[model samples]
Target chain A: MTNKAARNLFIFGSLFFFVIFLGLTVDTMNQIDGRAPEITKDVDAGKMVWQKYDCIGCHTILGNGSYFAPDMTKIVEQKPAGYLKQFLMDPRGVNPKAAMPKLGISSQEADQLLAFLTWISKVDTNGWPPKPILAAAASVAGQPQSRGQQVYQSQGCSACHSIKGIGGTSGPDLTKVGANGKDAEWHVKHLKDPHSVNPKSAMPAYGGVPEADLKELAAYLVTLK
Target chain B: MTVKYQSQKIAQYFYTFAIVLFLVQVLVGIIAAVQFINPDIFILNFNTIRTLHINALVVWLLAGLMGATYYVVPEESETEVWSLPLAKLQFWATVAAIGAVVLGYIWMGLDPQANKTVMGTQLLNEGREYIEAPRWADALIVVSVLLFLFNMFMTMLKTKKWTGIQGVLLGGLVFLALMYLPGMFYTKNMIKDQFWWWWVIHLWVEGSWEVIAGALLAFMLMKTIGAKREVLEKWMYIEVGFVLFTGILGTGHHYYFIGTPSYWKWVGGIFSSLEPVPLLLMVWDAFRTTREARNVTNKAGLFYTVAHAIFNFVGAGLWGIIHTLPQVNQWTHGTQITTAHGHLAFYGAYVLLVISMIYVTMPAIRGVTTYNQSRAYLAFWWMTISMVFIVLTITGAGMVQVYMERLMGLDYEAVKTVYNMWFWIIRAIFGVGFLIGTAIFVYDFFKIGKEPAPALAPAEQKA
Candidate 1:
């Protein structure tokens, strides 16, 4: 093969690879566009709040953002709308361990925020949060026990607590709590007002729980033992 | 002291070591492939099949790198290795490491209840638990790498000026030093453990070995094919550029689900998708140089070299692009597609290139010009054909697996049952082909230097 032939082959090959690349790029772009779930009007305002707060700057949604906050996408799916609204009203009410500062929105704004998060959860993230364990729990949203698992992972609950040989061992294990004494209703009342149960309890009250979310969350916690 | 004669002697030693280990690796590879056919084939059942795969790959590549280094260093330095005794020590240490790992696997198999230790402390132990190889084996492997590194670094330092090829060869060894980092941090957590393993596994195969392949292939072509040194050198430099360009960032692909940042998807996907660019340049350079050569000396070496170029282009370069795209990688990451890409790319491109260097240098080292080209050629063709079949089978299995596992949401067991039979059959068939190829090449190496030389010197005969 002469130099000329070699040069021609090189050029031709480059062109070929370039053409293949272009085709793949177009195909990928189309796939992304087609698969991306449309953002609904119901949650649009709430989503704007999420954006304005740069919620994703600290929190991941469907496994695509920061790790500083809970995975809000799954959280929305797992909790009731009223629970989310209450939490938005005062996250300290739900868990004092939350590092998230209260955004201090009104009842209406909090409701809108919950709607936005609910809409975000419905969007298809193409089965991200790739771990099978996490994905399974995420799929069973609104079931308290499953919701507990999501809450565990999302809120970095495992970072400070252990249950059933999983999660962080920093805090006391909660494995036998329900079996020991606390019933679902008692736990709900305690969660709504933890200091009422034990004046010296380190746990803070989750003031945001509307009645139904409180009921579901309590139901979920009851099964933990 | 004739430089060529000294180089040939070193090359002869490397040829012997390389062929022996090549056959050993092929045998281990067959066993590994068989395990995939029936995961319960081995009763010992200590380490997972993944351990077998990872260890075999590491050993095979180490042997190849040793061979390539032995052949190239003497020629580049225009001096014999400062001490053959040290070279021999390095080789034996490598052998010892391999033995230790094998024994570790066997011991773990027998004493399945032995407590698992992390960084020398008991982490977990059960009667049927997987036991990681004794830390001694890891230590020995690291020692072997260090010895090789010291020997090569010293040899290169003695050379007043470094050639472009030398730079790449040395750069590869330096990268090997970096491959040891992940093992330094032993962890009990599987997620953290796999994260670090990727550092070594992905970095070695996709990063450092690439530099070594490019350097050695170019160097061999220069000597055997009589390509212009300057042109080949320029190509080598460009090849290095391509390696670092994509390889450093391309590591993100392995981090996708390892509890790292989610942005790794975009970072790993985009950059790794471009990993083929340097490999493409390498394929181009290899072919162009071979074509430009006034005369090709060894038919077997030439064939294997060309095959290496083609496979690197298609297997490593093209097919790599197919699955490297973030979206595609998300689906195919741990599936058979990655396996197919790994086997063809690593064996065909990287391993074949090293073997090709051995083929080109064996007769030269023996001071013989022509001998048993037919056997080497036969081996090359056999391995090449088997590799193609293996790639085809795996790619088909991967596609089926992706559909079943992802699309149908079948559980892992169901997915494995669906694809395991056909995939394993193809793997076994390919294994047989590979064994035959390996045997032929090993036999040819012994026969070549022992046979009578042609009437004319090969250099004059070819030109």
Candidate 2:
């Protein structure tokens, strides 16, 4: 084909597509604007708080921002409003070594931030920033025997293995481990020398632990199922 | 040798500064990558290192583009630059502003009280991925761009001749400035904020920048290839048209998961997939012209141009499509898949375009129109191949991440621990290879000083 004719055809075709794109953008924007949530007074203030603090710098909301902090998109559903407010007011109060710097938000600002979090929690994220398996173990919540749970937490097992939907995920989900064909003896051996059970395991051995604590931790893990 | 205008020298200065910044950027990038493997080794936090790396990249690319504009406009218009003094002023101002922004990002803490005594206000880091520069620095960028646009416009106006390439370049610059304005308007409404954020990030890369790349490539093709100006210019128009057509709406791709409405799934999926069309056309035109050239003395320039087009088509087009669909994106959004696409696409399209321009212009600026054959060829292959390896390793990591995190329903922290080997071991190896290639390319660039001048007469073309 002649170059002139071909160039013209391509140009026209691209422009035709451009018009369609423009039309779609407008339609999409219209749908968004129409369905846009009403900005409540508290939500508006919370938004101002969010921007003022630059929460996005650390925490992601709806899969944006640095991944150093947890996603705040579903924070309201994950924790109580009061807990969230208190955490915002004094982050160290909730977790002594929390990386979240104290933003020195006022009590009123904390409430507003809570309201904002509540609003965001309602927004459809299409189930993003997926939750851990421990979060879904509602059946086992608060059922841990005191000694067994204490042994589990004190030994830093939670640092690598998640339970009750909160903890490190480097190890298998202990929430279902009880049903995963492992006995107390298997757990004790694995804890003493992880490489003995699985050659490729990243888990470090805890041979220094007291046999009693290891058995208690293993007993708690067995009950997770 | 062409008479060197004072303004053309400014382009060289920009190119020099930009290359320096690029080297620094790569170093900072390696540091950021290392943090993923072992966050404890680096005193500078991941946020600080990444902010510097990303901002440095944005500034260096702009510096390259500004330099290209100064060099191209003067030559194309066939006139002396409008104001050498203003160009110099703009360059220095830009450098100072960027330095301040980067320092502010590093020294300033996110906590307001810490900054209250040190700096006047609470605002320190902007925190947005690409637009991390503080308000003052962002304003400085707008001013620098306006100054650049004015200089380019006046020079073109004085010449009283406007080529199609000049028009396209100018148009892209204007849009680049305009698109940036939306990022300055921050809001608490997450969805609204995200909608405008994509306008700046996505539009510049996908939309306006494509035109700029096309015009620049067309100019290079005309010089290196003995193609008819009309043939190349005609395709420039067509390619630019396609860029605008698809690129403007391709902003929807980013909107899909940003709490925006659901319709973006279709809007983004359809239009963004077509965003690669313009690059395809440019590739076709570049190959055709190079094949038909009377003499191809600087084979590296041609290699860079062809590689730029081909890589862009694969990186921005194919890989981008891999996640553009909402169904797939729901699984891969914010994952290494996006990171993989980002690395390849940026390297392929803008980065390669700039390097190609530099290789093409360096010889012309020195009154030579040929490459330092052995060194240039080595640099070209090293960079191209190493970059491909980097893309592959990152893509492999992202794929593994998806299977472990999404399919297996693993927690984010758990997935991170499992995937540490990929980022630390595999990605780092490829990253080093990339650095080696970049070092070789930079070394070759400096070594060009003593190389023999290109023969005035056309030589038999290399295969």
> Which has the greatest lDDT?
2
Comparing only chain B with the true structure, the TM-scores of all models are: 0.90, 0.94
Q: What share of the true interface contacts does candidate 2 keep?
A: 0.28
B95-181 per-residue lDDT for model 1 (tens digits): 676766666555544453233445443222111111233455556667877887787777777764677777668877787677766
Clashing residue pairs found in predicted model 1: A86-A208, A93-A205, A93-A206, A93-A207, A94-A206
Candidate 2 lDDT for residue B270: 86
DockQ of 2: 0.22
Global local distance difference test of model 2: 0.74
CA RMSD, predictions in order:
14.9, 8.1
TM-score of each: 0.65, 0.81
Q: Which ten residues in a row have the lowest lDDT in candidate 1 chain B?
A: B122-131
Candidate 2: tens digits of C-alpha lDDT, residues B1-463: 3336646867878988888888888887787677667654576666667777777888889899889899989888988899999999999998888777766776654434333311322355665678867666778889999999999999999977877778778888998899899898657566777777887898889977887998898888876665687888888877887787777777777877776676777878888888877778888887888778765766677778788888878888888888888778887877677778888898888888888888777776766545556777776677778778878877887787677655654455555655546655666676677777778877876766467755545345341
